[model samples]
Target: MSELPLNPRSPLLPDRHPEPDFFVADIFDATPKGDQASMEHPLFTLATKPDMESQEYRHGDIFVNIGPSPIGRATVHDRDILIYCISQMMARINEGRKVSRTMRFNPHDLMVVTNRDVSGRGYLNFKQALKRLQGTQIETNIQMGGKEQWNVFSLIADATIVRETRDGRMQEVEITLSNWLFDAIEAKGRDLLTLHRDYFRLRKPLERRLYEIARKHCGHQKSFRIGLQRLQEKAGSQSSIYEFRRLISKIVSDNASHQHIPEYDFAFDGDFLDIYRREEGGALPSPAKRGLIVSDSARERAKKHAKGWDIYALEAEWRDWVTSKAIEVQNADAHFVTFAKQRGPYKR
Candidate 1:
């Protein structure tokens, strides 16, 4: 195989310029205030309960705040979450710590660029990341990142609605180094790709599809349909698609332990994300929830509700807290060790 080159098309510009091909994206979520987990982001859809431990986002897991006119700004929570991670990286990198290069810019954060800097981990409004860079010399944390790093914080947004062009009036968008990630984006983009923003924004449902597909092949299924079918089988004969989706939702939310919330102990990815690392990035998906627990409160709530979401509500609180404080983790603190595992000191 030929060794691939870096930034073949260069996603970042010298000093930032108007990109005619890109458009700004802003997300809005319709789920009622009481509908979702605060940290999960409004766009996250319902997942099959069975697949959550596997990180399989399910269909309808996310009720995005978008179109037909739309709801509140699409939940840019994921984007904001990533942005917080970026800033934390920036602070740590500036302070001489190395963070992980394998980072996921929260998909929910794709939204209208309101300000350069975005605060809180709720979401990443491209406009907000820019706002974050104003006082600092860097663009988003990604803009200041290196070859091995994802500069997801740096986006190349364009106008979504094209006025004088051929494709009717509509929004279009792009990221800074998409040309470089043509492959990863293509494979991952299929889950929830939006041409409108020139970025990869996977709604909760889309993520579910990707997870299903990933589960089927684990590494070999090339046909998307066949792979999808295999995912269905994993749900078992008793599980309907809907039931499966809700099950997965329950797993993703409760994966982490927050007993350390106020007293968050020094931990590492090995502690919580441990299950994920148990296998290679690909392998067969687990047949059942790895280590999920249904609490008495959750079991009681389940009797009254058709689906389990309050479980998500509890996780959302920590999810939000993680995002909100991610940026601050860069600061020299007593708690930076555990939280900074992904975005912390690098071996180099």
Candidate 2:
């Protein structure tokens, strides 16, 4: 409950030992569990950074600024820990088991779940990630419980190393996740999206961020397109537009050469960039194959209705919002404009 760090770091007791569990077993399977799991919305920095420094982003009314900790700044890499945490909680929820924001778990379980090493350095890095997750700060107006206030909070409220290895390395840990994050999880997980297991293996932070944007907006559709400028903004990248474009261009080339990107393909045409979902036999799936086809001209009109907006992302949101309504939207452009007004713009 307090910001103070726990201490008395010591070796594990003679009786305390790691017990292999389902999560651990899942790691060794040919296909990792990450392929089937989904990451929460608010984690894994979408921007790439090379050092321990603060980051700020403002999209619509939501504002987030992640600060550093004593150990180091929480990088997009550190998000692997939180991803495993959310995956565990979601699994339990799907099984109809009672879950809580505060949890006690063996560190080995997390390492296995996230496809991380179990070495001594791995343990140290895991502990450091805990510090970063707890130390990183965020402030936003995303309406937690329908209230509006300006307050700063960490991804995790507190953590304690409950058990350790023979050499004083942490073995088991307990953490209380911040209420801001927990509330998002509890409110029916529609906002979250699934990610491929190879997501952890991506070498570059930008690559991971691009995958998240694609997975978030593309879903299982044939493809989704966005302007390069908006992609840079959504990524929260501090790089110059020219440099960012160069980086994306390399990814496009790599995707064509080695097919290194996971579950999706990227290509550039004029000012627009498209991320197409890859099917089983290296073929791009078409919307027509899925029995949903829209004329190219209609999509162009939707984009014209909202300047500097992503039509694909908006379309997905509109579809979800109107799915439960008795009357479907007759005028797509009008509904989209209303959605655009509600979200406003991202002002840095």
Candidate 3:
């Protein structure tokens, strides 16, 4: 068969020499706090297209319902702005400096933080990203105060391009973040997680999603394991089970070879997958423990109160759930009993 012409559309292929649509330097200045990243929201789509279809995702009591808007739908790539903004704000907070929702920054600075180029086309893409963030509406049960109330808001409240280059490249940009997002930053910095600088370099959406799960769960711990089935559910991926398994196995193998993925390493043993942080010296401090402990008496009470409930299984779920939330429970045993009642008769 004759060799097919190089695919102009594929960015990954070196032989594919697509004509440059824009001129921007690919190198980025990964400065201090520049490589810092944060995500206040849970895992969402990794789609690059502006999909208008409405979708709902739920994990436990947390729910995120994305609605269509006239401007555009938010793509997962649009999350770059949030990661940059939140990471900067967190840096300030860490330094005992106050922060606010409205931020003024150079457009190029954002590109550096997100590991993008500073080209004319890149500037245009950045504006489009801002539009999607401002236009996409989300209804979520993520609380603002101490109450559990539904919040309806966009990812960004407003954006202003303050200055532009003679060639129409955006220079200064001002952003007013949605209250829902700002509240997440102010309420507790710990609610946010630091992502690797290479996160922006991840080309596949599913790979990004898996990395988020690893960052959230594994963090500084020696290792953490999740069943393949549970991981798929958590990812909310649409791929078939066989395809997902193959995809993940390949990622693990690839990561082992290159060690390109930051922060954590991936591995799988049979049905269980493990994520462990790389043993780099000067590890950032882990989040404070919840101090939740399941006592033997609590186990006894769980067995007595909830007949046919597996105490050990319930205890594991309770511990895992609370640990993920990073919250302490005053009464671990009583809480376990209540949780058991809700889940009742645990499945193997």
Best by TM-score: 2
- Identify the runs in model 1 with alpha carbons over 4 angstroms from their true place: 1-154, 157-168, 171-202, 205-249, 253-271, 275-285, 288-298, 301-348
Q: How accurate is candidate 3 locally (lDDT)?
A: 0.64
TM-score of each: 0.21, 0.67, 0.66
lDDT tens string, model 1, 200-280? 222333333333323322323332222223344432223565554444444344323222011011111111211122233
Q: For model 1, where is the 10-residue window of minimal lDDT?
A: 260-269
lDDT of 2: 0.62
List where candidate 2 sits over 4 angstroms from the true fold. Answer: 1-23, 26-52, 143-151, 282-348
Give lDDT tens digits, candidate 2, residues 216-263.
Answer: 778799899999888877765668886777677656644543456678
Considering lDDT, which of the candidate structures 2 and 3 is the better prediction for this target?
3
lDDT, candidates in the order shown:
0.27, 0.62, 0.64
For candidate 1, the TM-score is 0.21
lDDT of 3 by residue, 63-114 (tens): 8777765755775567778878877777677678898999888777667657
Q: Candidate 2, which ten residues in sequence have the lowest lDDT sum?
A: 4-13
How many Å off is the CA of 294 in candidate 1? Answer: 8.1
